[model samples]
Target chain A: MAGVRIALWDLPTRIVHWSLVVLIPFSWWSAENHDLERHRWSGYAILGLLVFRLIWGFVGSSTSRFASFLRGPRAVLAYARGSGDKRLGHNPMGGWSVVAMLALLVAQVGLGLFASDDDGLETGPLNHLVSYATAETLTELHELLFNVLAALIALHVATVLFYLFVRRDNLIAPMLGGSKQLDAEPAARPTMARPLRALAVAAVAFAIMAWISKGAPLAW
Target chain B: MRTRLIIGSVAAGLASVAMAQVPSVAEQVKARQAGMKSVGAAFKGLRDEMSGTPDAAAVKRHAAVLAGHSSKVGGWFGASAASAPGVTTAALPAIWTRNADFRKAASAFDVEARKTLALANAGDMAGVGGQLRALGGTCKGCHDDFKAKDD
Candidate 1:
């Protein structure tokens, strides 16, 4: 059974995850403290990570697919009932939560690109296009959603803890190590593709994200 | 025909009265120039201290100046508005269109700047730094919304 289970989260995913854990809060703190230099760099790093994760969700691995784990009502219900296979990757409901978190975070970071703290001291690069009223509204909404993200993160942590204690699942460990110890089973798996392919995908995503973030300026 | 003539006369009288009541561009310009001069001088004083060469004892005196003149700046906004009929100051149309928001920005600045001044006077560098940031935020904030961009 152990031999059958293939590596799911490749090295890039691990780097992105751990980097995000450090960068997200640091970005928030730097912005809050008016550390403009740090805030700007943190924002760029976030944009990079978000882009990488999106690409990884598509062509990276089977376990990483939106199609693989993003399931319907029955799947979620089964997951809630705790009868589903505790596979090597995200369960259905957890997959959707990941999607939601990623979407919200993307929005938060995207809006931050256009928001100004109303201080001429720190205008986002794209603030030039938006009107003052619109900019102010966006800034407020961006901040308000930060609190919402924090709540969602807390709920995520709580769920992980609950699963650990109640369901005897080591979800966090799998995230950290990219492997889960499952019960006795039959072996059947395929080899993961080359890391260079993953790196190439990441490069493409980064380029696309960079282009979109620049407002596709030449198109205008 | 007689009723029509009478109505025309009445309309003319009211029009003349309204014209008499309105202030001209020159009058408005003069008022804004005066207000800007006074406020600009006060700000210059603050800038001097903030240039990283502040005298601790002078902070108290300067705080009084900022406190006294902040209301004066608030009053100037009104006076300038009354005088300048249509010139776009950094003051947003929302100042008049959404009066509450303008007031909030102004009020917040006043409160925070005072707190900043107090912090400076106390020689609480960290507290003063935070308050200064807050004050700067409010100032830039109101201007960004209400005032026109420099362009």
Candidate 2:
């Protein structure tokens, strides 16, 4: 059925999503090739992006907010049963998937901060803060978690393909164009994303990243 | 006296024959590998020490060892050494294909290693740590471009 195209994603969210699409692979390549410096910096960028996303989830556009997408278990069950609310933002299952991915990414990046390799050449900036055993443990977790993330990413892509071909929902277009053509009026109408707020949030994220990179000194 | 002269000449010929049995390329590669292994061990030792009590003297010793190894790293990758295949090595063919870039990376690593050594000798653990990070970056840069991935 024909429907009006309404805004579904903000510019900042789209930028973050596409940038991640590029940077994630870049991170893997750098790590695989032993380009630890590039890998480390990519990780830092990911962390910063994640931080901005967390903040934007609250202060960003209507469709981008966590409150707009996250739903109760009942809603997810209903969606599974093919009887769910038609919404503009993420569906129930998709919402939870987003949450899961974000949580995993946070864990991965957090563990990386304390990780060290056997070569003794490359290490996290804050590796000195932890004991050798702790660093080693975190390093192991970091490696293992990447595999988990890779699997999840594969699943995510598969799901997106399913929506595109089977469900006839062009999810990629909405993400790229920041709007989706819907059958009915969007439940959550588009609102100003407040680019200034996003900028402020990004500044804070960068400051935190800079401090962490600088060994997170307690005092000046 | 003639018999004694013949025996001496035979012994000298046997020694030269034994030396020729070992190819020069193989010998060079072996020596280079040994030097790299020593550098790796020294780096590991430094990290282990830093992980514990941060001993300035021990760090200095290991850093000096690294610096010494770094200086010889360039000479180890001779022209013949790249083409000759004898022992198992992670060195990729690109090291020879991009000879100038590889040499630049090696030289950069040497500079960082020397800086790290000086910092360690000064007992400046913080400075040493910073230099170690840079040194590690240089090492990774070369490895990324030149070293083959372990399967």
Q: Pick the candidate with the highest TM-score.
A: 2
Please, what are the lDDT tens digits per residue for candidate 1 over residues A112-189? 877765353465656545655666678788878888888878888898998999978777776788765545442533
Q: Per-residue lDDT for A5-29 in model 2, tens only?
A: 7877989999989988998899889
Candidate 2 C-alpha lDDT tens digits along B30-122 = 788778767766776677666556889889998999998898777788776776545677778888889899999999989988999988988
lDDT of 1: 0.68
Per-model TM-score, in order, reads 0.60, 0.66
- TM-score, chain B, predicted structure 2: 0.82
Give candidate 1 regions above 4 Å deviation: A1-6, A185-187, A212-216, B1-151
* Each prediction's DockQ against the real complex: 0.09, 0.17
Docking class of 2: incorrect
TM-score of chain A of 1: 0.88
Clashing pairs in 2: none
